[model samples]
Target: MTDIAPPSPSSSAEPAHDRQNLIARQPILDDKRAVFGYELFDRSTAAAAHTAASDAALLFNALSYAGSEALVGRKTVFINCTHESLKGPHLELIHPERVVLKVQTLGEQATPEQIGELLPVFESLRARGFRLAFNQEVLRRAYASWLPQAAYIKLDLLAFKPELAEPLIKFARSYSAAALVAEKVETAEQYERMAALGVRLFQGYWFAQPTVIQAQTIRPSQATIVQLINMVRQQASLTEIEELLKKDPTLSFNLLRFINSSGFGLSCEITSFRHAVMILGLKKLFRWAALLLTTSRNTGSPPAVGQTAVVRGRLMELLAAELLQPEDCDNAFVAGVFSLLDVMLGVSLEQAFESVALPQPVVDAVLHGKGVLAPFLELTRACESADEEAFARCAQALHLSNRQVNWAHLQALAWAENLDQDE
Candidate 1:
């Protein structure tokens, strides 16, 4: 898991998955208890946890899947980076202004040679508008030479004794340019202690725990999307679809907005529902409506959750493209996207199924996790969760190669990220 911005702090509703890579964001708060930013941590996927490959995947996923607009917006993004990640191509994918590279001091002591090697990299990043964060352990005399580059100093409240907190705070303050952060603070007393030491930034459950929202009530607009999906499945004419959309101004507005979104690739604006229908056609409209079901939420869930659902849908569809008939691909897509309806609609899977008129296969795949599409859904979940064994089994059962699954996973992530950018 990494901090790729999942659900909102108070609404912890997540997409349902048997296996998937978990990405959670822990809020970092300012002195006034306002959200400052987030420190991203990954629990799986990377070889050694903080290796270059994992870091690159996290960064790329964050930028593509969880953009700055969704996560921090204008706030700081504190990402832990190893020495190698500094030189990797993924770092170049994002702008540096809002990112704080938490450079890990490799050893207990930093040699002159190591310092010499890192300073130039630090200088280059700083010159390009990136800030560097350091842990308190970097405060040792052996690593003092790197102190000048520090932007934020993180102090683990759990690691340091209460008495040493003040000394560490004082020492961190001596830098004048660095902000002190007290992380892993779990109690009111710890927060108070850190506050007294002039630590303006804080992280931990003391302020707020990550809320888990299992499901959310579907909005009126979402119900319209369900209606539109039904209409599309029945092969309704443009006039009929347009009439249904016209009934709900909000529905019409969102359809137009989505069609105009960057993902649609339209040169001119689509001002009318009829025009949108003509441009997207029936099949594509069904897909778009399916996507809108999650994205156009009146519920307080994070947008990332909806985007994650979209990724799952795309991944399933991509996996089925080779093995299943062309018509079955649409069912696979619907199954994948609507699989999270139980969570997205705040209802049981059976109850959620009532809203959308889906095929028996799609229904079976989603409700019982049994059907031809079920393994694709499972493999898609495995990709997200990084369940290598499950992924292998599902892929093999479906006669899909490791490279095929990996390629589809990457494409789905890119597709989801592009969808967000289009909006």
Candidate 2:
């Protein structure tokens, strides 16, 4: 790798269009079956046209808003880069060493003219120490010129015929220095087939799916989470809440630590659970407790998934604050956070909720995706999925403008990032 400095993504001033961006990542593994890196998908920018600005916006948000350390750790991040996006100023914002810019094909049938123009940009990026990745189609004779510049070539298992796999592997190995990556290897059979062909890296759902630990009893921390929720819901007195906190020393410490976190902006330190609860009040305390459940450090689920839940809860609350009662906003927060309890608890949603008491609206939203809080929950999901039509529909149904929704989405992501850091 060359000595070019990583782009200062946080310092870059992004346009208004970039503010609402969110990232989703798929893990990539090496032959030894360890996590090698991740392919970052900019789900928020999914609805936009493939332009340099949009692509740059995605990279900017991944690095700045979601945070590089939290998002990719010390692994490579694969980003799709069009010919135009590769040449854009945004490429200047990324660190080259752990980032692979996958140059997207120009079209279904890219003409020689199109490939010819992008060659120089590819060469320039390569010379600057940026590793280039491409799809298997780049192996065709017409695109042969790009072969030497490639650092990785991905073959989609579902896209190519099984018979052609061997030939493609042979061609890639003999002709280019690029490491071969097998994409969409959704089963053990496909994984073995690709490994037999000397493909060194693999990605798809099969490797990453959560293994549900069925019939497992709840953990002490999780039970505490539920107990706190119930106590807060029943509006327990200060002495009762303090007694509950005293039973779990760790919970008390975490509660104090969280209250004093930078995001809270407390004028003075919150030294005790009672003091913290008094300041936060029941409504805010419940929101904090519900959110704390997702940030449990011991869960099998990825921290990012839990963080996504936190974002959903915060987004729902922020959105609801504009259109609903303060109590309803609290319910919206609960609905959003509890929506992922099944994934977090490794049981069905019904099984997960049996222990906790929730409002009818929150219960309906979490269990049936119906009730007053349902639209807010749906809007939160639409933001995560970048489902533009769903977002518009939900926003319209809730009588919310795009600006309100986008502002809340950005704020929620920023809040989640801060919360992760605090944890």
Candidate 3:
């Protein structure tokens, strides 16, 4: 008979309030069309209101919880901030050099005086080694006070007429040393026009859209990951886990790297699998395994897919914790993480499951879509899609409120972002 331990305590606690925000990132490109950096934004609100609380949530989620270093690596991360947010304490948490604060106006019709008043804030930010980005309005003579400290001047191609590009570019060149960035460049012609005008940096869909590349065959390490998860689920002995780890060096390396990562918040470095198991315990070890399963893909899938999987897993785990037994929550997490095995491994769900034995509840939720955990998995997936009716249906079916679902969703996103993809 198989000995299955009871589910471990929930790894995450619910938030005090439902402070939910949808985070999205757009890739900024250079003249050669190579990715330069990402413009992180909040998709929860339609307009870029630039409120202090919204700004704080975006930056806090990115820098503190998301592990900005792991998310963007050494690339500069451009974040939108209000004038008030610039003075807020959130800026203190970031590595100023790695972040470029895109400063926005106080209101839609911000006056020259309003812009002039924040010149000192811009200067102070520059003195602290932080860079500032501004929009085309900074080129106007009325806002001259804020132009000199600009690191980047973003020209909204959609907002400004094409005929105004050269003049604006010339004005910006003469007044500020900031590089011109053409945002919303949606066509090859726009890219060419911008390049001709000496606009070297850009952000838009003209360069490339986000995609998931499917591999024809799975790697050995991927198989080992599946096997390891199975072993952990069955409560395999430490020796067995160690032997499995030894068989796959990639998995072993990733395991150590993940445990030692800044997100894990360990007091001491963990060197071996036995030490990791001893320190993290089987329950926590299972969480790490789920995370590694997504990120350790030697396959050609983009890091975004792995990142998305981690979020799904964590979201399901958190949601399940609300109503299900601890063991069911564990299965819910497995179901969620492995839900995208098809996309990550580039195989059919059945083929992916054939490599290793998984819990039937998880299998039912992912493959058959009929089980106790199936509704949770469905609700988790609906949160990512555009089908609002479906999301509403799924949430209603599960008795999960919008606030409850959104809170869990945001927490999952942050948890996933905190995972370091190093190694």
Candidate 4:
């Protein structure tokens, strides 16, 4: 969607199904257990009884690339790369230093020459502030070639028989690669063993599990919004707006951070929120902040809950055009955003409605599921539950095409992904 160059790998693997399983990140730490970076990991439950590492690096790279603008505000992200990437469009957009590619040395008999042949690619990347690394198993003999070329390398402590760690550690130290990580180290004894061998980066259940980092909420001071709304519409002077912003220190500080963030690529350095206002003007600024308000409130709602509301809202609007009339889509969109506002805001709909006003019918549908949108909302919920019979009835009743319903599912995912990236 960001005009990424179309990639064609013609991979030996087939198309994947069942994206239900979640992916998590493992912290790449130092010997002191200080946070150094994160290693991306994926699990696939395509079957009930089995799940393991499935190559999700392609999707991970795409999601990370898409989410970088938002995530860059705090930490440096280390995205994983696959064997295919050394030759593709990924190199064009992302630098190597910011990424620690998880490459493997191929077959068991792979030689140092094979790894050395990839140096020209790594050298070009290093010139652009990129970093390279290998993962899991690496041969003792090939270490001479692979170790010299990389900044960091990871080896699973469990993968190597316990006795093999000493030699592996000795081999890793020979080239003095910046770091060697021992992953899947579960117990304190295992950790102590790796640490003694000088494996600084140890990752496993011993550390911590990945969590959905709560995006901080911006509780705009009542006065901040009042002043912003007033000054923005009048197209007030920069000095006057700066004086007004002095009313809310937090708003001013966050506004500066947001403008300076990768999300907004301003050509010149902006030192003040007033300058940000001057650059963006009131209309754009207000819309952006309002969206920030909504996204800040994304909270911990299950993703499927949000996706269903979007599909329901869109479907209802489409139905409105057929059965009701024009001028109804806005109501529908508002309905979608507010459907779970009570849950997201931690207050009943009645209590939350006092803070934000909506058209009566829109509020009715959200609060009581009563109005034209209600029926569509019901249908969307059924599809999410995979209720085939309910979906068929709703599709028939609404005269909606199967393709139309499926298209809405994808659209919802896209919209959520965008909202996620923007946040």
1-423, model 1: which lDDT tens digit per residue?
A: 121211121111112111133345678999998988877665434435556655654544343233223444456677888898798544543557657899878685656787679989988898877899988887877777778888888898887789999888777677547888888889999999889878899998887664321212233344556667777777778888865653343354345444553223345655455677887766556545544453444433234556677778788878899888976886787677677766765568886555333567887888888978888888888888867888789889988899998898899889766642332
Candidate 3, number of clashes: 0
Clashing pairs in 3: none
Give per-residue CA lDDT, model 3, range 315-418, as digits (tens): 99899999999878767766776677677556688865543335689888889999999999899889999999999999999888999999999998776654
- Candidate 1, clashing residue pairs? 1-43, 12-213, 13-213, 19-381, 20-384, 20-385, 21-384, 21-385, 216-346
Root mean square deviation (Cα) for candidate 3? 18.4
Which ranges in model 1 have alpha carbons more than 4 Å from their true place? 1-19, 209-423
Q: What is the C-alpha RMSD of each candidate to the true structure, in Å?
A: 18.6, 19.6, 18.4, 16.8
| CA lDDT scores, all candidates in order | 0.66, 0.69, 0.68, 0.54
Candidate 2 pairs with clashing backbones: 7-93
Q: What TM-scores do the predictions have?
A: 0.47, 0.47, 0.47, 0.45
Point out where model 4 deviates above 4 Å: 1-21, 44-73, 76-78, 111-116, 209-423
Worst 10 residues of 2 by lDDT: 210-219
